[model samples]
Target chain A: MSTEVAIVGIGMHEFGRTDGVSGMDQGVVAVRRACADAGVNWEDIQFAFGGSMAAGAADTMVSLLGLTGLQFINVANGCATGGSALFSAYNTIRSGVFDLGIAIGFDKHERGAFRVNTKGGGLGDWYGASGLALTTQFFGMKINRYMHEYGITQSTLAKVSEKAFRNGSMNPMAWRRKPISEEEVINSPMLSYPLTQYMFCSPGEGGVALILARADKAHLYTDKPIYLRAAVVRSRRFGSFEVLAPSIALEHNAGPTVDASKAAFEMAGMGPKDMDLAQLQDTESGAEVMHMAENGFCEHGEQEFMIQAGDTEIGGKFPVNTDGGCLANGEPVGASGLRQVYENVLQLRGQAGARQVPNDPKTAYTHVYGAPGISGVTILSR
Target chain B: MSQVPVTEGVFTWPSDSPQLIGSRCVACGNHMFPVQQGCPKCTAAETEEVLLGRRGTLWTWTVQGFPPKAPPYAGNVDPKTFEAFGVGYVELPGQLKVESRLTEADPEKLRIGMEMELVIVPLSKDSDGNEIVTFAFAPVA
Candidate 1:
């Protein structure tokens, strides 16, 4: 029988752009907090996984945590590195190879870069060596297509941004805590066609640390342990996008988010209907609605309707990104996945103060996607 | 005009005219543009190279209105320089849709499903004056 893994403790530093501290410093603080919260000494962590995209020096981040005794593996999967690290730690515990593991994800604003790795090449490469690092441009392409196909108006897209900013106001950790007006979002500087500055996720710095332990050891750590019901990661099969009909294949690797969600649901023996809440990698406002439909939260082309009906609000049918997603909370790259997990853990543990779901969410899911078609999905249950 | 090196120095072009080099999978009969390292359909690395059709139909196109923020993009012009550049997907005879920049700047002149031909243009010159050429598509006569 396979052993089960549970999140015994979680800790997060403030989320925002930082220039005062190093990424390693942010990671060490969160790691220390998680260890203290779990009542486990730092020396007890058998393995450490550090997730960072631009931190170039990952090993130094691990050593800064004073976890020199543990084996360390650094992960840099575009934006999904944090979730990848969490999965690695979960699998390590499940395999009985380690009774305890720590996953640290952190990135400082100063270290942020547009391009991830130039090794394998990417979408920009195909466009004659264009180095467009702001992923908003790609999302802008999708938005343009969406507008062309569904007649979606810029006003509608701005509404999504307004709702996100309003939600962010309740999240003290969010970077842009001040609510934005629809006019502001609409008139914001256009980054790309159909996408404005307000529609893009802000770059920020922060770190999220999670402690995973064997089910038996979980009870010793915290009474509010959230079991890792399911964890799955998948990459896009090369050229899968080219084979589909042009009308259907809107973009490359857009299908993985849905596929990963389905796999996570099957593994957890649940469906979108069973999820009391959801936290998605909302890098942009349009992405929140797009991914919701793709993940089966709503029918295709019905996301706009759902949003207009307030079904995604705090007291609606299903609350999404209640802690404010990357759009409002800021995209720290390596720390995003763990940030979602952190929100899921808090909601499941009845710890989310202002943004708490009413019915006491027993189950929740977090989906994250990285560049070049990397994706991760995790289901959490109390 | 300066001397430009053609496929003559590398592999022989199937036709005297410009044609794109591509590969076709024997397993799934899938067509790949710019030729893939392996067959994405069946993962069969064994494939045959074939010349793609010179003429195609435009699927959709967009003009980059701003300069890209990253490297390898040699166009040092300001963001406004891209205010009229065009990029789009064109469907070839084999139902293959390939993405390429358009030769024309007027968006109104470009139409979906319009017949087009592949044209390789000089992207930039290296320090040694070696002209680096890339592919773009223009309306076919």
Candidate 2:
């Protein structure tokens, strides 16, 4: 029995380098903007949920925003940090304990590739130094395996990044907007054997905030409120073969995306056919390629053909990553999930100037998955 | 010549054949590498330490053309000495898949389902100059 909740307001900080700026400041800025968008005040927020990989607890807003005496929680769910925070807030608000809540995600991460701490938690020194600890290796190995098993070619792989950049070129807030060609993507200095440097998103800094209100009171905040039809976070089961798993079970089981997406679709009372737009995780182009199938948008071995046919463009049959995605915006970890939600909101609101999906989107889906085998999905409907 | 593992209690060395150390659940017979407190699958508290077989199939691999960030990586090799290497998951027979550095760095030579054998290789040296070694999989000679 899930109660209804509506996202009345959303805001985002520019996705790019934020040198010498603290994540807290970025979060405050976004929060202020969201409150202004909702025609509400900071003091009116009864609860706040925040997500960040490197930043400290978002609960410190008591001193920063002068909005003290409220329940504030910090959530960390690997790359799905923001989605997790938003899900938690939605559930809490739907539970009748709170009427209005703010879910925020912000991060100021170091530039370059992502690396894991190889200490403790059953991992040893060999695991870290093995070079498999770097996420790029996972993407490369995954797509390499996919190609070998599926007969997908390098040219097929290049099409994903090419589309990402082309779509990104239209997004004002995206980090890399210049439309890139297939040759540039395929030849851009391979970071991993099958993955070029441009194929992956660099760890960057940014912030996003969303204000949610109980459904009955939603109209009091804004006339156009995006209903959070489904919010789910799931982890990988056995044989999932997710990043940071160190070992894979010999037996086969469903991956996080599959498990989470099915549950989300069921919870939302919607199917893949009902979704007019989507924002799937694209840690790398290879990830996006696999994710499209894993999320049930297409069948396995069918993505390469879709990429080649350009059916995933804005006006295509399945519009995806319409706001450049992580490839263009880069990843700010905590903020990435909410950033996807932000793009979907704008698309639904018909505010997306150049990247607007055709025929007006009535429903949208956003998902994220990363280290430790976690996936989060959020579905929005008008 | 003396060699030390980067992590103790992970693998057996100084023998004709080296094997990874793993945990086996007594209740469900599930195998897990690097050991675990209890079986995550079966939740069996009764577990036994077992030495894994050194033979496996190269399930998948990738080239690490760029250097990984440091800390646990222990910047032992100089930046000038950096050489790209292959890293991948090697599926043990009827057991589990363990991710390891591959002896071969050439992507053209690496193939899925290739027969792989485990070998101990030196990673870096500690302050006292003890050779720190880690496990890797290579195409069977």
Candidate 3:
């Protein structure tokens, strides 16, 4: 087996409300679809890594998928669960212990704002009882400060969501398919100051699975294997602004997304300019705007200009979120990160139909940022 | 009704001037609120409890426009009676910014870098009709 790992197959369960369908059942469908795509069977998967934050234990899926006794570790990294699972599977293959493995993520969440488990999140009961535990508040405050320091306008935030829905209209699996105008997004009911209801992605259900194979054997599985160039996860540094923090250090510093993105690019021997397209986390419109700079796609304030110029549009200089990102797809914590990777894989393979980025992109990048200040970044090449 | 702090040891109670209880890292001089054990910055085990400054500037803020869920949120859940509250981080000079509820809920009343002072306010009431109080920051008039 070669040291390099490649994704030979990919599959997904439609991202949205699926009444009466279990989250684990979605994962089983995705796994089966991926197996069929790669012309492999369940027993061919030597090892696996998967996770579902709100759903049942990932390892228990074996009861339905056949208990092959393969080592399947459950990962719980909040919103970075999918990326963490993919990272683990990549390393498992790179370590030469397994030639084939699967990384799967699925989740079903209650409809409404995600209730923070104060005690589980390392916070006290008073922290939540005092009504200071909402993640939307954190996003609003952080972006409010960012807009103040960076001169970004509320219109820019609206534009980002407008673009998300526009792209989502073209994605078959996206939850929100109708195009929303910038004016509509800005005029929507204010969930938080400067953030309208349209700007935030709700918690929902979905599942994604990818089959990995050693690079040397990748050709045997499929001719369109997407090589996994890099996969890295990073936690927040001391002074970075993170979700659910009761306090912040006076000395501000770079966030985890910046760290993870830099490390992923370095590992791939490429730079942001080398990427033909990218999929940055857009849990909220502000997150997409801030993460553009955090991922080194452009400087801190350049998004104001790039956004206005439509530089991030599907046909623009650098396409982003061709699969509508979390904003349009809604975030199923465990599946959100892998959804980014799945989009990049589809874009790189030139299978992204209407939302396909121009120029037959050869390299793609993805970043996912989540609560308690952790980020995951991945680089893929066709 | 008798007044009681929502949680003990978070801040000095029953005093006219109450300061938040935080820990200062002896190794790196880093400060954190609500009293954590180790230094998150320098990872030093040695630290000392210190009272944070009462006055600070609003670092950033937003409004909790909707009523949050119960259990974790002890505040009023009645959408009609639930008043919107300002949530923000107040930057204490040379120390750290503590996240707190702002007395002023109007967006026009709050601004980044505005001076704010800590004050005790009623968060809710317990089963016995005792008022549960929590610390918050108010814009200095």
Candidate 4:
């Protein structure tokens, strides 16, 4: 209900691990590409939001982009950092505070294992240490629980991975482009019970940057500007004990993805049924299925059936992760969220090429979540 | 002697030794751990401090079969050494469900709704004999 902020330009560095480019270097490349795509000069940008999880504060990402004159804000919200940054940029522009802004999400996550800063003043000691470790393990444990509760076979989870790899094969940007069979996914190294290596996203390096401007100025930047209809951010709170019933509250809280998605749908004046394309934060294959149900894309425990029915394919009811998701595209932390947004921008712009959803899509949604249950949902339209 | 520099932090036993202080919003009566600069729910900056309980019921858990990819967590253990460590979601007395690591490595033994307590232990030891302590949880009788 605020001022309309449209994505004037989008740019992405080739998605892969690059030894030569640090996070900042890759960020600069994407930023330059976005600026060029938007037909705007670096000096015209009034504000900048840099999103990265692995980089330390003052890590040249903000300054190196030649955005020194702009009001720069650095954000690190775990995996959802990029989407969070985009939300901040949209709000800033919508507030009439800035006319042009850039949200840059770039990360060379291959540098280290994924770690969340659960330091003092964040959560209780018991909740910080054990809770985080427990949540990371929750995916595997939930898969086990799903197996026990629903009588789902290991192959049920494997089918999700097999489909992701198959979709990745058609995506030039995906890290693992080779089609993987169900037997291969089930037989891969088991990280946790019922979850195999192929079931998880491979850690890699990449960059995704987006440019936003006031609706009035959007056409000056690009003829095909994607409008930001809704951007919602929400965090999970410890629900009641009864809410923790048998299968609901396994992780940090009632899946924030669903809550954020619902809020976004209401804010955008639309529902899951109206979505033409979607790019979800699929850190693991099981998450893809869980989120599909939780986000109202499908009913509970019906995601496996949907995948088997090819309802989630490029030509199906709703094409998901056309550029491949974190599972096949690699979860590059900071870059992953914006990377999803970039895919939406491309699909709406009719530039997705081989991975393009069959029908000309008008509305798309991208969702991303981070540690301790930070969630961001964005609704984009042409 | 190892040359790791120990970071200064208190370690608590029975899991909840070092109490986690959180702020309860005076406006909305919402509770948040590790305290917040402002109430995220109602945007209230004024609040009161409360001590969270130690013991809770296990919600669920996972083991770090693979060593974390981050630094300062290196050389202590290899990912292969621990195939499956138990982690759990523990429900505190105040209806708070905290995520924590279980003392048991076998995932099979971990049961839903099992009782658990908090334990703060050393995450790693620096070369200078300093202990980098962090929080974790273990099962209770």
| TM-scores of the candidates in the order shown | 0.87, 0.97, 0.99, 0.79
lDDT of 4 by residue, A131-245 (tens): 2422346677665555555555666677777777887888777778898999999888766555777888866877778999999888888999999988888777544221111
Model 2 alpha-carbon drift over 4 Å, by segment: A120-122, B75-77
Writing each residue's lDDT as its tens digit, candidate 3 over A151-223 gives: 9998999999999999999999999999999999998988888788999999999999999999999998999
List runs of model 3 lying over 4 Å from the truth.
none
Residue-level error in angstroms, candidate 1, position A272: 0.7
Lowest-sum lDDT 10-residue window in model 1 chain A: A242-251
Candidate 4, DockQ score (0 to 1):
0.19
Go through the candidates in order and give each one's C-alpha lDDT. 0.72, 0.86, 0.93, 0.70
Interface RMSD of 4: 6.1
Cα displacement (angstroms), candidate 2, residue B127, comes to 2.0
Q: List the residue pairs that clash in candidate 3.
A: none
Model 1 C-alpha lDDT versus the unseen true structure: 0.72
Ranked by DockQ, the better of candidates 2 and 4 is 2
Ranking by TM-score: 3, 2, 1, 4
Shift in Å, residue A340, candidate 4: 0.9
Over A26-59, each residue of candidate 2 has an lDDT whose tens digit, in order, gives 8888898899989999989999999788776777
- Best model number under DockQ: 3
For every model shown, the clashing-pair count is 1, 0, 0, 25
Clash pairs for candidate 2? none
Per-residue C-alpha lDDT of model 3 across residues B1-141, encoded as one tens digit per residue: 899998999999988998999999999999998899899899999889999999999999999988888879998999889899999999999999999999999998889999999999999989999999999999999
Best by TM-score: 3
